[model samples]
Target: MKSTLRSELYKALTNKMLYIAIAIGLAFWAMDVMENQEKIKFFDETLQWAVNSGLPIGTGHEGYSLFFLWSGLAPQTKGANLFYTVWPVFAAMAYGWSYSDERRSGVYNQIAARTSAMRYYISKYIAVFVSGGLAVAVPVLLGLLANAMFVPYAQVVQGLGAVTNINFLSELYYTAPWAYGLIWCGVTFLCGGTAACLCFVVGTSLRYSVMVILTPYAMFVAIDALTNSLRASILKNVRLILSPLRLVWSSPGWANPEWWVFLMLALLTIFSFGIGYWQVVKHELA
Candidate 1:
């Protein structure tokens, strides 16, 4: 299993389309930051949209503005949970190509005949996560670097819409803090991995690979829109799509999330892995 997993990881990393797509994403991200240097115009629009979407507009509160800024800007940031879309899309494409092509070429059955099906499944699962992580990490690091050096991090950090006299470290540490940034990035990774794993299951069954690739993303969008239609009171009390990103608004008196929510999510990931393994182990009618 370990050897197979390592080999699969290598194949995933060497995928030509994945490499090209990452290069294109990096180029676009660089251009976006440079053109919007010192102040991204979209930050303000994002803030207004949050207000319109029912984020509380507290007056005379010192923390409210900062809270609003984080809530709004996070969605557009490359490393954020809301941007999990970027990670999963490429992951699904790359993994789908790997899985579907090999099966079509009879390489899958050949491998299964030699290796345990469980090993093959585990190898693919690990490879998919590695591929998804790289898809997210490369562009994210570039965006963070560009934001720190060229773009006015202070303006974005402070929601001020103007560059201020703040060092990059202070902008990063004091404004949002590195700990918070790490958590947000972690959320993005997990969400992306979750979506990719789900899509891997679909790819094993779907006729058109694109349909499998897009399923997770479509579900997220559909769930997000559905959550928006619910009452604000209900939405705030519950965790839903991008709900962790919405934690910038968790009321002071509200109860902390039950431990069960975390447990349930962990179980979900485990279950998904099992499903992916099962699919690979069974003979397909194709």
Candidate 2:
């Protein structure tokens, strides 16, 4: 299993798609930051109010500022919400080609002969998960770092109040911004990795790289549209589960989700992996 994992990792590293995924993620982040600069500046200007209210302005506030910046920028326009609209596509592209590329290059047959189908499938799944997660996480982390460098750090106070979302306004973000950032990044990783695996499942049978890669993004859009059209609060909340952006941002009202939300994400990933594994095992490599 270890050897298989290493071999799969090597293949993922060498694949140009991995780099392309990272590049796309970064490009979206760059565009989001540029588009949202005014919001960041406005937040900075509000620091005087915080100062008047006896708030501390220092490095401790950097994380909170960045968190606030992200929250504000993320929901302003659909285009700014890269976590939902763009990350999944990049993630799908990152691993969508895994099986098809291997099949076309004849590596699938060679690897299949040397290992059990289950082991090969599992190894590739792990590789895809890691590669996809990093592709999404790295760009967001870079954006966070940039915020720390450019945005003024101002402590949270009653006057400045909290960001609308509990996740950003929570004590966790105020007292320990780095840890908060880590948690957000972790959620991003899970969303991206799971999205990639779901694409892989489609790729196993679809055979077309473009369809495999774009399917996840299309599904997200459909869900978003459906949820928007729904009038019931319960259905809207349920649909939030399907939204990677909401999951990561911990959007207003749904912020500080119950443990079941995380469990749902885990189960979804496992279910996708199980389906992909089953399909690959039953597939004819001829």
Candidate 3:
């Protein structure tokens, strides 16, 4: 078990696709930051002008904070949209297709000679989390770091858009901005891992690597299509059930994304792991 787990971890970490996915994610982050450059400059100029004019700056008056500058939390720019919109691609792109590839290449059978198939599958399942989570989370972390250097570390002020926009974790945003950032980082990791595993499950059932890679994104779009129609309706209460894409987003596009909606993804992760285990170990499908 330990050897299989170690082998899986090594493969996951060393996959060229993992770095490719990370680079793609960073590209999205870079575009987001670039598109928001004008806003950043405006805020910077505003703060400088206020300081130069001897204007009393307080709370709502000042805007150069980590929250406002960070690519994920910035206001009004859909710059992060490109990143968040295709996050599933980033998630699964890292290593989700490994199972499908290995199975197709006869590597699974080769490895099965030394270890139980169950252990191999389980180790790959666990390895998926490390690669997928890092692929998605690292870009956000880097964005936070870049923004932190760009601006002074100011707590999210009540009057700012950043504070007001925090719908799910408002308390942490108010009290500990650091915690807010960390929690979001954790959320992104979990979501990415779950998404990758969903694709991993698809790989168990399907032959094509592309199909496995796109399974999560396809399902996400399908769900979004259904829920978006509800947004057109007058039932404000219904909007609380955001699609997985919006659920993972820091700032939900429409109605408030409840923390409870994330449970669906948790359920999905367990289901995929369960079904994959059943197919490979019990049924010997793979």
Candidate 4:
């Protein structure tokens, strides 16, 4: 089982599209960092515009003491925002292809002849999980690197401590490139893995495979569109980036979710894998 799983994993790793998407993400992050001139301008202009226009400088609609800074290069932040937004879909599609192709081409039957369906399914999950993680992380890490260098400019002008406290330890621990990257990547990985597992369930239970793959992502998007303001607090601490990404710019960037939110995320992760495992064990792999 281990050898069979390993071989299957090795095959999944060779996908060119997966690597290409990751490369593009990294390139965008690098470019965003290298060009910080606009980010500074946006930050300055937005704050001034807000104050001049008589809007509260750093508060939410409810008049909560929220510090909202508009960086000149909203595009860079938007890029980071979009990067996390679209990455999970890339992961789901890439990993989904692993099984989709096998099922479509009838290659799965050949594999099932020698290995258990469970082995194949589990192996696919492991391989694709790693791929999804990299899809989210590579670019985020690059962005973090860019922020580490060019971010100083953003801090200096914005009065780094004015909007929010930037303790060196906090940056080192939670807001640092690696730490923030991991948190964001974890969000994408879970979302992607959940999407992939749902696809697998759909593959075995239904004929049309696209529904299983696209439904989860589509559901959240629709909800976000419908519920803009309420979603900010709901998704703010979900650790599920889908929830937060929906309102990232609207809400405070560093909003720490309640502990219960993390617990819920953990539960959801386990539930997704558990469901996938159950389906794999019973799934008819032809």
What is each predicted model's overall lDDT from 0 to 1?
0.53, 0.66, 0.75, 0.51
Candidate 3 C-alpha lDDT tens digits along 146-175? 556555577666766444442667667768
lDDT tens digits by residue: candidate 4, 1-286: 7887688667756777567767777766665554453655556577678888999666222111111112111233455555545554555555555666577778878887788777777787677666655654556545655555534322222333222332112343223434433454455455455444444544544445455446445655665565555556765544332342232221234333434334534654566567667665665643
Looking at model 1, residue 169 earns an lDDT score of 23
Deviating ranges (above 4 Å) for candidate 2: 35-64, 71-79, 158-169, 231-242, 252-258, 282-286
- Which candidate order results from sorting by TM-score in descending order? 3, 2, 1, 4
Best by TM-score: 3
lDDT of 2 at 67: 56
Off by over 4 Å in 4: 34-37, 40-76, 153-198, 204-213, 226-261
lDDT of 2 at 278: 66
lDDT of model 3 at position 168: 60
Residue 208 lDDT, candidate 3, scale 0-100: 76
User: Best candidate per lDDT, number?
Assistant: 3
TM-score of 2: 0.80
lDDT by residue (249-281, candidate 2, tens digit) is 544444445464577568768877877766778
Instruction: lDDT for model 4, please.
Output: 0.51
Worst 10 residues of 2 by lDDT: 71-80
* lDDT score at residue 185, model 4, on the 0-100 scale: 43
Model 4 alpha-carbon miss at residue 169, Å: 11
Comparing 3 with 4 on lDDT, the higher-scoring candidate is: 3
